[model samples]
Target: MVQEEKIPSHVAIIMDGNGRWAKKRGLPRIFGHRAGVKAVEKIVSHAANIGIKYLSLFAFSTENWLRPKDEVSGLMMLLSEFVDKKFFEIIEKDIKFVVSGRLIDLPDEPRSKVLKLIETSKNNTGMVLNLALNYGGRKEIVDAVNKILASDIKDIDEKVFSGFLYSPEVPDIDLLIRTSGEMRISNFMLWRLAYAELYFTKTLWPDFDEAEFDKAIFDYQNRDRRFGMTDEQIRRGNI
Candidate 1:
């Protein structure tokens, strides 16, 4: 029998190139960031409708703090505004909003907004929308290691270690998509993306709409995952 196309249980995206998008139009970078917000809303709603269980977005990274102070400030304000505006709508849609990273590292206003968003959506039983803010892949690994070291348990394996990460409830990523033509992982989620099918597009994040999102999922469905098994094994349905 011909194998049916598989739907990924979890999808992660590195939203890149907002600043570049704004620069090309001779507009402030914050304008691109603002436009990216609408794209985010469209993609999230579309993903939930299409039966994707988990959607993790790399919103802000540890390295992003190295940007100019004004830009960082603008980003923080935008994040706060996003939460305030979208919290109730997401709850009504039965989507659970989650933020994973060093929460304390964020400014007071954004941090408070994030906490409130999580609290209000905590009861929802639906697709997860995970925002990785002030997050780094290597840093997450180190943090997990520290958690394991402090514990009394002796068992150390992939499953056990995964529980120590910031967001352990979510499963490993099945597909990872990066926009703006970026070719690197950029420390988004090191451990979770081990065997994920990767997709890259030249389209900037601000302009990445539902059609672009559909294309990413379509590309992912075409990938044949072996998980270290031989091609013959896969063909024989042994994987």
Candidate 2:
């Protein structure tokens, strides 16, 4: 059982295997993406109920643009529709909606909807729902560096550099869950995942549920995070 007090403050997820899920069913990839949206709905609600303070979902990656044009357009449409459908629920639930990526690269419809979501929910005092659309960890670091260069900041440290990130106020990830049996981070949250506990599941993203999420939390709870200290040091409360 996961302890309530030990619940991770920030949980990030790499939602993968949608294409594979659709391929396995001999259906179009868009169908899989559609199914993945439903899973996102379920997991978001469950995360709030389970005391997850911050839930970041990697919805679209910068590399995803290399895919077929039709599929890309379809994804944009889906995102716009999803935001429109969930706009009221987000406000009513007091969820703070945030986006971690370049909104300028998004299609006009989706970009406008996303900005609206952030603006409308700015005052919500509840669990934060961060969507990583068109996000690449490497790109994020580069973008931050460019900002620093433009400001003519010669001296900088990790702490100061972090403030330039797309979502600077969000804390470092505590738990990172990747589905579809993928073991790689794939350029997601490069800076924020410095010391995060990673959990990979064989279950596809469309099939990931509350129970699957709990299993990851349980696994995380059993681990002893020494963070470079010896076990004896941890036992002696010398962390």
Candidate 1, lDDT over the whole model: 0.91
Superposition error at 77 for model 1 (Å):
0.3
Clash totals, every prediction: 0, 0
lDDT of 1 by residue, 1-239 (tens): 11234667899999998999999999999999999988999999988888889999999999999999999999999999999888888999999988778888999999998999888988898999999999999999999999889999798989999999998988899999999998999988999988888999999999999899888888877777999999999999996
Error of 1 at 221 (Å): 1.1
TM-score of model number 1: 0.96
C-alpha RMSD for every candidate: 2.2, 1.1
Top lDDT hit: 2
lDDT, residue 233, candidate 1: 97
